[model samples]
Target: MAERLTTQQVAEQLGVKVETVYAYASRGQLSSERAPGGKGSTFDAREVAELAARGRRTPMRPNAAGEPPAGEPWASRPVTVRTGLTLIENGRLYYRGQDAVELAARHGFEAAIGWLWGLGSDAPVTLRVPPATAEALARASAALPDGIRLPDRLRISATVAAALDPLRFDLREQTVQAAGAALIAGMVEALPRTAPDPGPDASLAARLWSRLASAAPAPEALACLDRALVLLMDHELAVSAVAARVAASARAHPYAVVSAGLGATDGPLHGAASPLAHRLLGEVLVGGAVPVVSDYLRTGRPIPGLGHRLYPEGDPRAVALLDAVGRLDGGAAVVAAVAEVEAAAGPAGRPALRANIDLALAAMALAAGMPAEAGEVVFAVARTPGWLAHAVEEYREEPLRMRARGSYTGPRPSEGPERPEHPVPSSS
Candidate 1:
């Protein structure tokens, strides 16, 4: 058995007061056991000596400026990461100093993207996918397994497109913007199309709509879908955006940055939220609202489309998109079902729960007669511009700067031999 030492003996060996020894035990730096018959606690001599030895060998490490960095994980605490892109304030979102809601309402999705990219609103938003590039992306995407989701197919296409772009490593503003536009256009054209292409001059919404729905969409439905894209363009520093920035910080090519964002968006709680919300909206559209709401609530899961933490007063973007939905033909059933569901989900005092952007996208998809997963496709395409903009921003900063520091909680490097895998044979 390892030798044991009384608190006084441990304190003397370590040149610390007895109280300091007690503090070490309390802090788990020292292991102690109680003695029988009201005797004082004693520490394992081996443990105490090992800890002291580690302390002596390990010198304090501070930076050249002589200040030690914080040890706590930033994830558990609120941290300020500076970015001038999108700002969420007073329950409203702003993209580069313009109100996001107003921008979505008054301008096209590409115009809002220009603003995020530091281009003046009057700057032209280009959507031109070179014929050769589009063909290559199509061929690559077509080879993916049928069971893969649309976003995964886009990710694969991104890889192939990046491989083809010789100037992909060019971090200049004009070059990055050109690459971003071609990538978005290629992704849209590469998506499996059902309805006829509205031609090259068609708006992005028109082009993407053809791929998503078999039937033609009403003009108002196209407007609503376009607005949804604008609203989703940038939400200041989302998880996927952070992932994109991390890649950009490493100076990864723009297509690679978007590939990173797409990878992060594949998570259920992030970009995939729209599809789940789409499913709920479909059930409500097919079944009556009350029964569907009851059945969904009975499962003890929060309704997917309702409420967002950032918009307690209600998501203004959702309000804006839903207003456009109101203008759609045959939109009453969807609007009414949404209203009944919202009514059934009466708030319990905290500013009143409201439908979020996911619900808005789902409503738009349903009203436009698109498939349940179409909302996710729209989200991925819409967010591409913002991802590239962030990549540009990251390229100007220090490389590999977003790395996280971890606190050591595992076995120490100086730890003595671990317990034997098989105890030494009892030499009886």
Candidate 2:
């Protein structure tokens, strides 16, 4: 009998998440069979090795028109976007050549945003909205039912802010940067506060903590939140950033660019990961990680907040944030739960999945006594600056340049009944 490998073994061999191994099986790139007693699926070791070899093969280059080869789908063509914002290389992340982890430790979120927007790193950024604008946003948000999620409130608030700002359409560098700061502030302020307002003079993270947590702000917790904001401020060409750039390519205003980005950010695979991870960690903290992980595996759900594709070794942002989270009063327990979850998911002789930023965000939320949706709120607010940065970049490009030609995959028009052309009525 040929040797068969478990899913974890195959994932380790391919240097991918276990979920990706199932994806390969679903796509017919590999085949699977029932293991003994039908507990789990197993794959032929030789077949898995062949699939890995194929994945390592060199990809075809685009032709003269910068398109995929004939008969290949247009979606198969890689889009190369030039960016000076952020870089993820060798399991490390950098914002414009500066080490992101170092920057987060040494600078505030606003300072990082200033640097990313081409302003000096030490440039003072005031993330405040005019009193009238704040009142209007509060009223508008108040109109929504209390049951609405924080992220939805943020989306609605962005729209309201855009409507109220007559100068939102200004795409000039300084103007957009100013508007971006205020937009972030307004989004944070619009949320119904769970604690007393930290006042406008407080750091953005401090202000945000008031909204997300009912407890008074602790110095270390506030510091962790600030670091998280700086670490998440931007990632080069993320899904939300791409959506924002697409809006900017059409010359949309900064607010609309953020709205587009938010639309893409609300999905489970993207911005919502943090909240899911939060719930996952909460469950682990209660009933223990082993059974929770086993339950997730039994249901074939990809463990939330593990194994980011961009960081095979580990997510640096997660490392920095998790380290900061460990210093929180009760954070050590939560961090231990995260580790237990990781260990439970990866057995002996398998590559252990590393925690991602979402997991770290969840840890922060759990340790800080935040609501389940706190991580999602943090993600939305933190990434707003990033989306705006991309908007500024896209505004400088040729308008509508991000548009792509669609390849029709439906039934051919010729296959349908041909309609007779109707004569145009003459204007008498």
Candidate 3:
């Protein structure tokens, strides 16, 4: 029989308290078996000796500010959640092995959706809002006050659609695709239209333009917006997509998954970036780029739309969409302003700061005479398809597989709330 060491022996060998030995066992750092005749738990003697030599018992100490040091690299580790939707690397975005930039320029958003939805490139695409669904969204949205934000209006409309869809709970592949299309279409049709309807066969960009801006439909501007939507469709493991997947992992109905995604998108650091960037662009146009950018830097705030962490060189999506914007009428002025901001806001001696998709989206809206808030609406709507795609993937996984394990740091069950044994001795 292999030799074994008692808990006390193991603790002494590792130079930690006995309680720490128990803690290590609880954490699965060391395994033990019940001792013969139930004396106590015993660990493999050889394993204990190896652990002692390795000095893993060195207590993890806090920094000067009392913050604990970093632990396991769970956040950055390469764990798998199989997806072929979009790949982001070297500042480029790809959808299921095809270049996103090329697709945006060559095909409109419809073809891109077919690719993302696991359908072949030649699959027929049809997206439509049922007349009843549109009417229901309109009535639900009309009940809200006029000042409600566009995303909030979208949330209310989505809830209405969920309530109306009788087959929303169906998780079959075909049912999911049908439900996703209706949800996206309802969101678009519910937006208050300012221009005349562009007819049923119009591209989503054209339909959305009527709702967002009063400017008459120009083919170039509409095409620019279409490419923007296609490019923005999906980005792997983005926070909002993770939120949608988490909901879907719980087998949530399609509408619930979308609602979860929309909730994450409302966070200022994410979906709101476009509107903030639009405002920054307006400020640069009015106040002169150099002074406005210099002022923003002095305040220690990130210059909106100037840099993205994921793209060290630059965002390819921004490059493609901004190029399209530059090709549109009256786009040269916006391009010049963008160039000025890039030069002025960039850090000295470092690589030139690169513009991100938010910058490109803001520039597109400004050049096209759309309202600043319209960019945020566009982002939310464009990202809906990607969220649904993640939802579909999550549906196939075991329920709650994404659930996280908590490492409790609180007092043990035996150690209840502190109470002086002798009533604190009547401290005066």
Candidate 4:
């Protein structure tokens, strides 16, 4: 008989969690069998070692004919986009081959944007709107009813900024980079400042802090915000990034590309998670995490900001930002609340749901005394440069390559009402 390893042993061997061990068994990547008396599952020792080796090897790529290697997860995807910007693998993220966490730690948000855009790491990246454009944005923003969400303000600003830019259609690399910087600047500047302006020479994080919070930021709090911005800058082919790329494929201007991305980001599963998490964290802080977590599970609602499919082990961005948030003066309580929520939700003998970036964003917002929607605003502004970076890549591809052919599932022509040989044209 072959040696058998317990679930925990297999997880340790694979450098994953017990949940991931079960996932591997379910996916047929590894096999498991009931232990004595059906107590728990055990894996064959050789099989565990082989799976670990496979995980360690670089992922196989498609051949010259573009056929994916056998058992590739993305083999069914019809359209493949080649990019040099970001990569997410082995539960870690990389931007242009540099570790994303390391980049966020070492550089500012603007520098990260410049780096992602293929601009040099030291490139002079300034996010500033022309005074005339800023004024127009302010006027447009003022016409909106009070109490509009921050993301809506960003949408309006993008539209107005587009209208003001005569060269918005230029797809040249430098032009796109310039427009992206200005668009981000305009979006941040368009929000009504809750605190005094931090001045033009201040970092983008300082400028954004003024808009999100009424109180002046401590140095550590400001650094946390800056880290979040850099970490959220680009994620490879996220849903919103894909939407932005599709618009770019059709030769839409940079502003329209962002609009498409924003439209996709307004849903609960994406940009909206932060606000939901903020509310959840507030409840957890008021009541105990046990009751709050129990209530959510009892109501059959998914706890927001818990899991991310991309990072099965854990989200490095969350770990990084949460560490920064913990450094703030009153941040320990919020961080403790988060830890309690995680512990209550995971419990023992079940898959533990690790915190994602949304939860970290919520913690940052709560610790900084920013409003619930502040996290969503931060997400939108941070991802804007990412959408533009994707646009640049998509622009270089064949026009409309992302146009997908629909698989007809509706009633066939024979099953529908008979059509006339010549359809009548409608006349007014």
TM-score of each: 0.78, 0.79, 0.81, 0.79
lDDT of 2 by residue, 218-322 (tens): 899999999999999888888999999999988899999999999998899998899899989999999999999999999999899998889989899999999
* Of candidates 3 and 1, the better by TM-score: 3
Tens-digit lDDT string for candidate 1 (1-428): 87889888988877667876776777677888897565898889888777677645544344324453233212221233568899999998999889998988888877777788888777748888988898898787777778677777777778878888999999887899999999998888778888987989998988999989888777788888899999999888899899999998777899999999988888767777878877877787788667877887789977878888888888998888888887887677777767777866765564435788888888888888888788888889999999998888887764555655467899667667569788898889
Put down candidate 3 lDDT per residue, 310-385, tens digits, no spaces.
8888889899988989988878788778888888877788666878889899999899888888888888888999
Model 4: lDDT of residue 264: 88
**What lDDT does the true structure give each of the candidates?**
0.81, 0.86, 0.83, 0.88
TM-score of model number 2: 0.79
Off by over 4 Å in 2: 1-79, 415-428
Query: Which stretch of 10 consecutive residues in model 2 shows the poorest summed lDDT?
Result: 69-78
Best by TM-score: 3
Query: Which TM-score value belongs to model 1?
Result: 0.78
RMSD of 1: 9.1
Worst 10 residues of 3 by lDDT: 70-79
User: Pairing residues by index, what is the TM-score of model 4?
Assistant: 0.79
